[model samples]
Target: MAEYAEITYTVEDRIATITLNRPQARNGYTVRMSDELADAFGRADSDEEVRVVVFTGAGDHFCVGADLSQGGFDFDGEPDGPWQEPAGRCAKRIFLMNKPVIAALRGAAVGAGITITLSADYRLAATDARFGFVFTRRGIFPEGASAWFLPRLVGMGTALDWMISGRLFGAEEARAAGLVQRVYEPDELLGKAYELAREIAASTAPVSVAVTRQLLYRMSGLDSPLPVHELDSKLIAGLPAHADSVEGVVSFFEKRPPKFTLEVGKALPAYLPWLDS
Candidate 1:
């Protein structure tokens, strides 16, 4: 329930929704908004009651890119020091979160707008949504670690084409390129996102979801299967003793939905993120 200047954070059922709130500005990205977003994600990660997160924007636009009202040199004003870029901070937080995140995208999502959602688990876009990589046209490169995430989400060829051209494209192209999972009518986007979120919250084990999210994202970068095999061995060997595993088995035999009690904040496995030998 923390207050934010450029965003709204609220929780209902087991889903935490983070809404970009500057409708007049077209939900433009700003340094303050990045910090607030990171904080909100941290809050959701630590709250045992929160099982999923939904991200969206207010008004007609998801985001139109950086707020340039401060002038053309706004980005250059960052104090000279080794520091994480504003957009990267928020994106990194989303990447590391234990809870699943779904983005309900509509209207325009350009530059930082689209890049920020690259780390989300799923993106449900409105059929009318427009997307642009726009950074090349602005005389800057992609930020928000899109250089790394974009290639992984969409193939390197598509990533390079979109980013190099920096042209606007429609949601259908986005879905074909694998940037979005599904497309819905403008008014139905959020409702569909929430419905998916509720299903995950109600049916999945929190600890298993947390571990699976990290495993998939983190392991995708590995060059060999040995690392994955090692991690899988450890997880399979240890998971049999967990309460969630017992309940899952019992429920399958009893033909009933499982009520998982293992909490992500308190019950996550200690050997997660598998260290190399």
Candidate 2:
């Protein structure tokens, strides 16, 4: 329940919804907003009650990219570090989060706006949502690690086409290009997002979900299946002793929903594959 100037954070039914609140500016990206977003993701990751996160904008537009109201000098600022950009900060936080994240995108999602959501596990867009990687159009390069994430999500060919062209594309095109998983009417977007979140929260084990998320994202960068074999062998060996694994099996046999007591905050395995040196 933290108060944020550019966003709203609320948790309900084990789902945390982080909303971009600057609707008048089309939820324009700004330094402060990025910082708040990173903080919100951290909050969601640590809170045991939060099983999933749904990201969306307050009014109509999801985001129209950076706040260019200050003109060309908007990009001029002291470095947080050598290469750390505001959008990257938020996107990295989302990438590292243990809980699942679903972006319910509507209206304009351009430049950093669309790039940031590339790290999300799923993107459910409204039929009217328009996405553009407008960095080249604005005379700058892409940020938010889109170069790394975009190609991985949509393949190098599609990513190159979109980033290089900087043209606006609708939700259907986005889905076809692998950027979006599903599209809904504007009014139904949030409902569909929440439904997905609820389904995950109701059926899955928190620790298992967290570990699986990391394994899928992190293992993709590996050079071979040998590493995956080693990791899964380690994971499966230890999982059978955990309460969640027991409950998962018993609930399946009993034909009832699982009541997973293990929390991501406390129940995560100590030796994660990514944590290994």
Candidate 3:
């Protein structure tokens, strides 16, 4: 029931679509848009009927980065203020969501635009999509925790190269460097994203996907597999009693689609340490 002025949020067929609405401005990034995006992400994450989130823009462009209409940034906030950088809030919200997020990008996805989508589970871009870590060029630091997420996705060397150079790259380069998972024509981009989202919604157990996502992001960078092994043991031990486990097994044996009834908000195991954090 939330109302958004800078973005449109709608849920249908288990997918929540969040579109940046400032098309005339080429979906320019703004503080209002950032907060609205965070709110929409939280709403979809909490909605049991929304198993996936599609992040996209309404017009030809996804986002052309900050609205620079006022000439430049105004940095007059009190040092002791509780204010958070708006873009970081959006990134953090998306990072913590239990439901999967797929960002569909076309045209210009530069500066904050590109950085924000780096946290999504999947980035599907149109062939015309152009991306840049343009903060250095703009005389500002990168937002959306790009330093951390970029290196993990594209490697430290490529991250350093693109970030330091502040150069724009096309979708093919983005895919080759691992920044995006797929590329398609602009017209076909959203269709493919929805197709992949549908596949996930139909085949995967919601609670299981949530746990596995957290495990991969939270545990994969460890120096050794010992901790992961221990956590995996704990997770595997409880699977027999899990409702989704039963449904998955029965559906597989019967050669039918799984009717996994476990809701992500409720069915995540209590032993997950990060849930409390």
Q: What are the lDDT scores of the predictions, listed in order?
A: 0.91, 0.90, 0.91
* C-alpha positional error of residue 222 in candidate 1 after TM-score superposition, expressed in Å: 1.1
C-alpha lDDT (0 to 100) for residue 242 of candidate 2: 91
Instruction: Give the TM-scores of the predictions, in the order they appear.
Output: 0.95, 0.96, 0.96
Off by over 4 Å in 1: 73-81, 274-277
Best by TM-score: 3
For all candidates, the clash counts are 0, 0, 0
Candidate 3 stretches greater than 4 Å from native: 74-81
Give the per-residue lDDT of model 2 (tens digit) for 1-277: 3678999999999999999999999999998898899999999998999999999998999999889888742543766668468789889999998899999999999988898898999999999999999878878899999999999988999998998999999999999988999999999999999999999999999899999888888897888999899888888998678999999999999999998898777777777856553
Q: Is candidate 2 or candidate 3 better by TM-score?
A: 3
Lowest lDDT 10-mer window, candidate 1?
71-80
Please provide, for model 1 over 33-132, each residue's C-alpha lDDT reduced to its tens digit, 9 standing for 90 to 100: 9889999999999899999999999999999988888785244355678767778888999998889999999999999899888899999999989999
lDDT of 1: 0.91
Q: After the best TM-score superposition of candidate 3, give how far the Cα of residue 277 lies from its true spot, in angstroms.
A: 1.6
The whole-model C-alpha lDDT of candidate 2 against the native structure comes to 0.90
Q: For candidate 3, what is the lDDT?
A: 0.91
